[model samples]
Target: MNKRLVWPLWNLALAIGLGAFGAHALAGVLDEYGLGVYETARNYHMWMGLAWLILAVAG
Candidate 1:
């Protein structure tokens, strides 16, 4: 695969890992309100990162 593909794949993977960590670890460590914020931020970040990944792959 191209380097572009590899980089985006790596980024996508990192986003997934971070999102999972936030959900699994932060949710319990933080209070409900804080957890909600963390989840929203991480979820958006992951989704935007995925969009970038798709753009990288397509363009």
Candidate 2:
């Protein structure tokens, strides 16, 4: 695969990995409020990664 093509896929994979870690590994580590912030970050990361994936494909 082209290097440009691979980068977005890698980013998406990383985002998913991070999101999973946030949901599973972070449970009980953060308080409710902190967890909310963590969740928000994960959500943004995943969505932005998805956007990157889309852009890569569309371009």
Candidate 3:
């Protein structure tokens, strides 16, 4: 595997980990408003992570 490809994969891995953390570890700890904010941010971060992976592979 090319070294350049590692970064995007790492980014994707991080997103997945964070997503799980937000969904599980923080699920009940935060209030509704806080949870909403976390989800919104996580959603965008996940999307960007996906995009990074796609571009890394295709570019």
Top-TM-score candidate index: 2
Which structure is stronger by lDDT: 1 or 2?
2
Model 3 quality (TM-score): 0.81
Q: Which pairs of residues collide in model 3?
A: none
The candidate 2 region of ten consecutive residues with least summed lDDT is 1-10
TM-scores, one per candidate: 0.73, 0.81, 0.81
lDDT of 1 by residue, 6-49 (tens): 76677768878887888787876889898788778767877877
Alpha-carbon runs more than 4 Å astray in model 3:
none
Candidate 3, residues 1-59, lDDT tens digits: the string is 97767887888788889889989999889999999998898888888878887888788
Candidate 1 residue 33 C-alpha distance from true site, Å: 1.1
CA-only RMSD, every prediction: 1.6, 1.3, 1.3
Local error of candidate 2 at residue 8 (angstroms): 1.4
Q: Candidate 2: lDDT of 45?
A: 78
Q: Output candidate 1 Cα RMSD.
A: 1.6
Q: Between candidates 2 and 3, which one is better according to TM-score?
A: 2
Error of 1 at 36 (Å): 1.0
